[model samples]
Target: MGPETLLPNGIAHYLLGGLLIGAGTVVIYGATGITAGASTFLESTLSYVSGLPRFQQFRFTATRDWRVVFTLGIVLGGALYGLAFGEFGWTTDVQWWRLLGGGVLVGIGTRVGKGCTSGHGVCGVGSLSEASLLNVSVFVSIAVGTALTVQALGVSP
Candidate 1:
């Protein structure tokens, strides 16, 4: 395979993407003192339809409007990228149920860990939070171990 097959946009695309994420994270935090976490963004969106006290918390309800915009940006960004780059549709043969199960486990992990990777790894670590540092370590270790274990078990997509 050629470099194009491996990295269509080359290293510059990855570098630019990381820079954009960092800059956007910095800008959002600077503007509102809020970390750009997908999990919390999702929770905030729930406030619009769910009356649960957790969802109705001042933090989620008060800022949900902008959170919705942020969430939409995430979705639209991927959609636009796919449309522009011809990368749409499923690329893996993994079963849908397995994907759903994995998502459910990740959701639980976010709750138990008290934050997702973006929350802990990006914002929390940037601010030098000890918990975030530890959480990111655990996340990375578990991810690596899981991949190894799956490969050992002869798992396929």
Candidate 2:
């Protein structure tokens, strides 16, 4: 059967996509025994607990201080790959404030949904949890609605 039903289209897409993603995650983890990504785990934990605060706890638990280092490594790796393939070159200037605003929105959304996309849409739904499906539905709906509203309002992305 097609991966759609009477349920919300976003929910169905997330459910099916999550299952496939989860399976892939299992196979990868089975072989490597290491996490493929850290954002989901970090966001989920931040959502469920109270203390110094979810974000603070996430920062400490997820070692977010090292994220900069990891990001730098990724950039360096990309640069190296580009150099090797004769693709290295300057790119467009980045808008730091815009990026920071986007990051803030993502963090807020993750907290509201009790997980990031990876957590609900990939890991949770992968396990076939009804809760994950619901969360994904809400998340996708809100995101799409917001995007459309922004566009309608002539807000530049």
Best by TM-score: 1
Using lDDT as the measure, the top candidate is 1
Q: Tell me the whole-model lDDT of each prediction, alpha carbons only.
A: 0.88, 0.63
Off by over 4 Å in 1: 1-9
Tens digits of lDDT, candidate 2, 1-115: 4435445455855687457656756864676453334454454354445455645554445544444444455478678868886976655354778778978888777767766
Error of 2 at 88 (Å): 7.1
TM-score against native, each model: 0.89, 0.50
lDDT of 2 at 32: 49
RMSD of 1: 2.7
